[model samples]
Target: MTVRPILETHSPSSDPSWWGAILLGAVFILAGLIVLGDVVAATVISAFIIGIVLLVAGASEVFQSFSAPHWRGFLLRLLVGLLYAVCGLMLVSNPAAASVALTLVFALALIASGVVRIVQAVEYWQWFGWLLLVSGIVGIAAGLVILSKWPVSGLWVLGLVVGIDLLLHGFWWITLGAGLRRDNRAITA
Candidate 1:
């Protein structure tokens, strides 16, 4: 027996976007589950997907940087985008090696982000700065742990992250879709 979420007659979920969300959520959940089943394969696949996504994002960023006139930090953005594309291409070419490399990069990035966040918290203490500080602490700790694990962590981290992310996204979409459908029903009623 399939249980359905409660919804009003004219629910917002009746909208096409709601439907899309449902589909997206379902797909993510399915994919996440699949990946969780075989972490090694999932890690490799995740690396490849990340590479492709980064390449596309980089290309888009580079194009936009040049398309704009008198844009501030245009060169910086362009360079960053190019770097993303190159790194992505490298990931695509050798996903296994890339996964390991990416893990190291990820750990470093987390630590850097944590430090930056802590600095921001210090600068902006009045606006939930403590929260930021805590987050930064957590980030630093997590990064350190990952770094400590090194290669052993690399084989599983990417897949685990991807799986969790997908599951969360899937849940979000499913909830959104169910809500929308309920709203749609209410509206029509």
Candidate 2:
């Protein structure tokens, strides 16, 4: 059996479908801009959505446990599901508080990651270690800045991160589309 590569049979530029990627990228960029415009609102909305997802997941887990009552772990699963539901309810009830708690955890994780990166960089100090060290420093600095702002930073950090992510994703899609178009042109020529 032989596997055929799709690209070998058809050029990306030959198909007009790549245009959709560019269009989607534009939409993502627009959404990202909107999210960035109101960090507080974005954070709250994000938390609410997460809470809803958790609620749904918890309900599903509980239902699954009940359906298979003979399973040895049924009691444990039910308890875990209940815990998830309670936590989800808490978040939905007060997204602002949930954001604060989540942000603190994020900041702490960033700091820990930076520390680990710095330590790892020591093994390659003669090569690209400097780059790693710089990245670690930046991470630590960012984490410290967020921590300094504390609860206030919580309101905006998650939203800012999400907006930046959307912008980067949009750029990636646009770049991919451009590359595909270029490849198509090259193939035709």
- lDDT at 115 for candidate 2? 85
Worst 10 residues of 2 by lDDT: 180-189
Q: Give the TM-scores of the predictions, in the order they appear.
A: 0.50, 0.70
lDDT of 2 by residue, 36-135 (tens): 9998899888788878888988898899999999999999999989888887888799998899987887678777877876886676454345545665
Candidate 1 lDDT, tens digit per residue, 65-138?
99984889998989988998998899899999889987888778878877987897687554345655765776
Candidate that would win on TM-score: 2
Root-mean-square deviation per candidate: 10.7, 7.2
Candidate 2 collision pairs = none
Q: Tell me the TM-score of model 2.
A: 0.70
